[model samples]
Target: MLKVKNALALISEAAKSWYSSNPFQFSAIIAYYAILSLPALMIIIFNIVGAIWGRDIVQGEILGEISRAIGRETAESIRMMLVDQGNEKTSVFATVVGIGTLIYGSTGVFFQLQTAFDRIWESKQTQTNEILVVIYSRLKSFGFILIIGFLLLISFVLTSLLNTFSKRLHRFLPR
Candidate 1:
């Protein structure tokens, strides 16, 4: 009985702390940044994975998954947006600026996540250079994105191999 009461009190305290952190507002902020970041994130991932597979295959797999999660209509809209972004032709300066923008946008969600985590953990940093800190954080986030792209590519290749193996195994076994 005492253990149960102690557990309940601990749970209640944790809940109050979580509620005080304003999780819903943080979630809303993260979602907004994610929406803003999606195009750039997709473009980066497509570029990374497309080099190994093909853009069409990567796009098809990504869109198919998105369609399943959301809907075909939303996926189609995303495809259109990606197409438009790909088709744009720009001058050297504009291209540089666009690339910078894409990197910044792609890292936005991760940056927000870092902020939320810091807030939740009540971490205090004693940094002399704010700009450097921000730069480091963004670079870390970009590295994470690159790792995700690589993992996604590996996953696709592995899945394809597994499917082929499964079919061959079925031929040898009684099913």
Candidate 2:
């Protein structure tokens, strides 16, 4: 039918546009940033969720999920990396510098994604100040990281409640 042909044509055009965007190059760049950011991102997320759930529990739950997706060996290596990073002790000045670095690293992937999106959309906004723009971009990325942490906390709470409810329901039901 004409409708089916039109639908196929639309899909083909979208695919062509997507391919023209050089998605693989963007993906490689994003992956590189993500690798650099993972440690800082994980530390921030753990701290946020650990405030309520406790660090061990949150870390275990996250690592366990990762283990399921990947493998236990890889998960254990990630745990070791986190532990090694966290165990380091330094002077107050050094600590401040490290924290700043971690924040910058954590926001790298988000900033890169924002750049990629702007390029893909061909967005042009009037620039006021370069420093302010950089600050705003970093702050926006940091806000996104915080939102992710909040959502992870909510997910854990919901999963815990659901498991408890399921157990209680099982007790009441005639198996």
Among these predictions, the greatest lDDT belongs to 1
Predicted candidate 1, C-alpha RMSD: 2.0
lDDT of 2 by residue, 43-100 (tens): 8898889988888889899999989999999999988876677576689999899889
Candidate 1, residues 13-41, lDDT tens digits: the string is: 99999999999988999999999998899
- Residue 127, candidate 2: how far off, in angstroms? 2.5
Q: Which portions of model 2 show Cα errors greater than 4 Å?
A: none
Estimate the TM-score of every prediction.
0.90, 0.88
Off by over 4 Å in 1: none
